[model samples]
Target: RTHLDPSDTLELRSAADARQQWIHYESLTRDLSLSLTEQLRLILAPTLATKMRGDFRTGKRLNIKRIIPYIASQYKRDKIWMRRSVPSKRSYQIMLAVDDSKSMGESGSGSLAFETLVMVSKSLSMLEVGQICVVGFGENVKVAHDFETPFGSDAGPKIFQNFGFEQSRTDVTKLVRESIELFRTARTKTSSSPADLWQMQLIISDGVCDSSEHEPIRRLLREALEERIMMVFVIVDDVRNKKKGESVMDLKEAKFVKDESTGVSKVKVERYLDTFPFQYYLIVSDVKELPGVLATLLRQWFAEVVESSN
Candidate 1:
């Protein structure tokens, strides 16, 4: 279960506009026969369902949980189980590491990152499964929310409001290191089978890192791999257009860079792509496309896992 952070400013719309957006989001979820909890239904009730239908009319016809089985059978050609007995199934934890550095404030790009967070949170909520921990870091790291089941709108709103008060100051190295430490501690406290748990570390950032702390970041990745945590880095490229008219730049032009001889020698690039025991890297130029991108990646990831198990 995951709690989503609501937008700081309720994207209040005209009655007509609200009706339209509700219909759009609802139509997307309707086909699955996925019932939103009473709270979610109420929150979205003010808007007409018809409007939400059009946006997802042709959107990916995939549920978050289905991705694993689809990928397992298609890509890996392996038998994959869609549902496992709760006791036998591994607990899945998604540790989110968000960038809060000074650079993050440069282009008013935070809104895009915020939107990605919201979308991901919403998707996770719909799944109503897994343990999720949302962490924010800049100069320091803090756990914004932790959930063992899907959260309601009130809970989601609180998480988002807390995020609004959190400012960026921590470096990526510290953020990564702290997150790994937290996971380790949490693992020890929970008397669950480590093998049964599918741990994922998701880093969302603009791919910028503090050069001086290169070694620490490398070591952090190594430690995460040693613990059997699957690390995923989602590079949030700056959006091309914003209300502030921010210009988008190619990833190469951005801070992330690679050195042939040293292999990810630049701290930013190195931290961005540091190898892990089982890892995946995704670079997305637009936030709007993130949900689909994440779905694709998850499918590929689970396919590999299922194949290996077989």
Candidate 2:
């Protein structure tokens, strides 16, 4: 064994601690990522099946399943036979915005948020749907990953290396505006395709929108809507330690709560969300529940796409 000074020993121990924490985070998220990936893949598979391009009219090939209906029509319904086409692959574009405010470092929220980002981003990217961009925001916002690069190739290492929770406050509105510009830049650099219709932004935070920027967020929401970009806020509300009798909000939304102990956790969230609400929002107790919540959200969205294709 080699002898070392006190400073050198302390430095080595600090490095060991950091490495251990990194492994802990990575291992925790890896399993969740795999589970979510399989769930999403199954949900998306149905959409890849034959979709009706036209029916009750002329088309390339007649669907055999419709023959019975065609015959029952007494040959009057020529359009009973359907024109069908199967999409080779479904593609999508998604952006993930995570709040890295100082508060995030509280109650282990920062670790939870970081794990959420890695799991969701990895699962989605594994599906090979399209590119995903990630942004971490607090007093300021910056891209953790850009749309120009592949998530696995470049964004992965950059995200893992650069994650820090040193911001003083959260600025939800600023993040929204910046994302719009980022999207615009992305559009310019890439060729237009059907995947453009699937563009979406998911903002993840353990807190509600900044009430100070209420008006600015309202304005930005309109622009985001007009652009046909889907915006979803995944709000993580930690109600685990709350008193059993106390409610997050009014008891009305409580009726919908699956947790009898919590009563209406999301109802309380609903009030805060009013400041900067999107039509699509999700609530969960912690980042650990994200695998299921995210899978359900994507399944619902993909279902809509399948319906529209018909």
Candidate 3:
């Protein structure tokens, strides 16, 4: 959905008013996020309906076998029992890289993307899904918020609102490369990291990438995939075109190959997406649909994490 132009809609007399509005929005977002997360958890990983019961074999329940030994000595807790049905450890980090180039703003798609990011980020934060980071990229990369920032805070949104998308070019390769470095550094600093930690990168864009940067970006993505990092490329398009395939002009439409002794032949193929190493989704720029798509993806992410943990 096209967002109202802040220049035309916002009439703030003072910075305080702006701050108040930001706070109000943040609170509302947090509440919405919490609700969404609860529903998702129920659908994706419902708590076992079976009641907790004492197990004579081994569990949090006192071992009856140890009762005889305990009778002969002072009662003390022992490792004789295990935590029953303990939830698997899932250590994953989520980062969202938003395209903040001028063209994104031209159609007001950028604002819609920002809202989707903010809502999803807040919801994930409320669920405590994983360490989260928000990055905005145009000609340069900007870390709008990181795990250290308080979840559901207005800081990230504020930074996004003030960010100018006047850059002449989009450097997607630089953005991905920098994000890799950031993730590496973060993994080191994180305490009690899980054995099979995974990283999820969500790239929300119009799929506009400079031809010169495509190869490098592709290579970086391949490296990330090799390292078990999951990438989600979300292409925000017009609502009229809800079909999913790929962005037009995402790759060369026709390739000409010359035979050694014959004339050149043009080769046509479907989405060159297979050339890249990531899951791709084409969705309309609707605020409601965007968040639902992200939530569903998160559910799948959790399922994957559970599988990997096992």
Candidate 4:
């Protein structure tokens, strides 16, 4: 129902080119919010208006008010709850583990990763998620920022550049083991255990792990699973078909590979997949889709928590 004025310049060479561009642009704009409810009403009147006015006593009539609540309830059921000690307090902690390897830099993928992380982090802050700690790793791990309070507008780009330096390739096995050990050591050093607080760890990586000498990551993952820690893995790659091409193997395949020489387990492969525990895995072809994907994921997650609270 929305019409484009002839005077509206699409900055294209000709009207034909403009028309073609509009088609693509319109698809993306389908998910965007309209300026006013009247605009939406005008567009839907011809088709949706008739459906909305059908016999309410029958099954065909659409009750907008009831329909909204029903859809909202469905979303609420999909969220995951984080345990907290204080009944009145509503917040959760998120730990981010970002891979900053030489390969990421070479492919110019680090920028994309950084941007995606920044967007997620900022969005979480707006949702009033509690303390957030961002850790960047290559050969070593370093804290980019630990925000007790929400990050400001200038914080994201600054934090991105602060930990943007590239190092050696990523060793998932070693990184997981070391990060877990680091957390335990820090907890011990403080002599304070906040057992009531819920902790969630999220890892962003390309899944191309480092060499075979690294220790098994699976063992650490098993421990995390036993501990009931919430873990998420965001795998960024363009891998479509698994059979015809090389793809990052899931935890099961990544571990317990057979060796023809001595019929022994492949230690390197075992270490990488087993050490890092991931409850949820999200695979995306590119970073451009990350923002929308993350928004939807978080909305689902939060909706559940909100419903449970009520």
Candidate 5:
């Protein structure tokens, strides 16, 4: 990890140094490209097919019976063609909100986060999955890339190189609000595409939210819940083995009840985030494990699409 100090700016090497570092990291993680490609090949197409219907304009494989009838009619003006059924693609717009605060640079978390970012960006770009938006946020937000351009083409290096430790605050609510606007913009532009557009946002943080912004953030979460946008918070940290076994991944909920003959009582439950359209995952310190963990979570996310489609 390269720690940059205020006085070190001029003393350090030039832009060439940063570019070389980026290139080196890319070369090192090159194997992940092939590995992610195979996983995507097995997951993307088939999963979409299970849920989406084929585009109507594209004809399916010729049905023998329909073909015979058309042939008997000497290819008459009768429209007797069966369009091939393909996956009715439900476009998933994924926005990755990465934390680039000073704290992230501690505990080796920055490197882990960057590694995960590269793996995911390259993987999704390779598969050409729905719109991929990567944003690095701390005090404010920095959009590293959007769906209009490929992930690692021109934006990837900038995202990695521009990550500084100055900005330290996290405004998650604002980020979500901005992401919603982004989705709305895309929706308007792609009105001709299928209506099955699913919105999913992944937040890479250290299980910390600005205390003062909690209420507003929860409100934004509720709004997201109503909009059916799946919010996934990926906490990049070490695991805590508590006797209660309650991890940060669990959502807190309160239940109220009254016994008609007796009295009223309140109950609290630590449950999975099924009641809301959101969930959280904990990523251990092992950076290499991130790719597999992400792949598994994405598979689960795609499974939700399948179930909803049915």
Candidate 6:
């Protein structure tokens, strides 16, 4: 199902106007996030498999946690002596990386990126499904919110600040590598960090990858796949900015222009995303459709992971 932004567009002529728009959008996003999260919780509640140890009939391992409760109850051996530890299932871990290159800013892309990121991540967090890491990339990859860090008002504004259209390159390969490294580094810091959780990387990009960056990115993703890291790509196509009757697929063709000012070449995003080795992916022509698209993806993914664990 598609979701269209209900609020009318506000012209941003000054910093004050921009701030007002940001506040308005943030409020709307938070409300919608809560509503969506409630639905997600309902859908996923039955699938959650975390169960504490129970004291009942005798078992091989003693359940220390229930000993005090068992003594307090003063129940019979059959009712209170036996304690079994039901091993919990593995949890889902998510990495949300967004493209912050210049092309992504066109066609009011910034708002769409911001809206989609907040809506999906906030909803997932509320659902308490797993640990989540948010990263933004352009010239360099930046971690907007780490796994241990809480995603609140403070993290939201950092995305807005670093989302400038100044960067000319979208080095997604670096972004993924860095994200994986961060996860590894996190694991080293603690024995029980994101190492064992089912890792799913959901990358949000405009598909504006440069020509030289494609093969390396492809190879890196292939390596990631070999290591059992699930990849889901979300392509933000420039459909609204297209000329008359140009379909979304037309955005896959690359157009290159040299920047004489900086002696750098800028390339239009070549979104031959169908060839990419993503386990699951989708293209969104209209930014407004993003929240719904992501919600559906997440629901299906969470359901799949739960099934796999079971």
Q: Which candidate is the best by lDDT?
A: 2
Would you list the rank order by TM-score, best first? 2, 3, 5, 6, 1, 4
How does model 4 score by TM-score?
A: 0.52
Clashes of each: 14, 2, 0, 8, 8, 3
Q: Candidate 3: list runs displaced more than 4 Å.
A: 1-35, 39-85, 88-91, 196-198, 211-215, 240-277, 280-282, 301-310
Q: By summed lDDT, which 10 consecutive residues of candidate 3 come out lowest?
A: 242-251
Residue pairs clashing in model 2 are 56-79, 57-79
- Per-residue alpha-carbon lDDT of candidate 1 for residues 130-160, written as tens digits (9 for 90 to 100): 6677777777787777634345654444444
lDDT of 4 by residue, 1-310 (tens): 5486656644223444533433433343333222222232332122222212322333543445455555678844322222222223333456788888876665555544554565456545554435667778878887776635356654454455445446776867766766676555443433223543445677887766644533365567777655534466787654442343344444333446679998987744343444334546676565556655554554564465447657
Per residue, candidate 6 scores C-alpha lDDT tens digits across 278-308 of 5577887654566566667768876775587
- The C-alpha RMSD in Å for every predicted model, in order, reads 15.6, 9.7, 7.4, 17.2, 7.2, 11.0
Residue pairs that clash (backbone atoms under 3 angstroms), model 4? 216-271, 217-271, 217-272, 217-274, 217-275, 218-274, 218-275, 221-275
lDDT of 2: 0.70
Better of 1 and 6 by lDDT: 6
Candidate 2: regions farther than 4 A off = 1-22, 44-46, 52-83, 192-197, 240-271, 274-276, 302-310
TM accuracy, model 5? 0.67
TM-scores for all candidates: the values are: 0.58, 0.70, 0.68, 0.52, 0.67, 0.66
Which scores greater on TM-score, model 2 or model 3?
Answer: 2
Local distance difference test, each candidate: 0.56, 0.70, 0.65, 0.54, 0.64, 0.65
For model 4 the local lDDT of residue 288 reads 54
* Residue 50 error, candidate 3, Å: 12
Best by TM-score: 2
Candidate 2 vs 6: which has more lDDT: 2
**RMSD of candidate 4 to true structure, Å:** 17.2
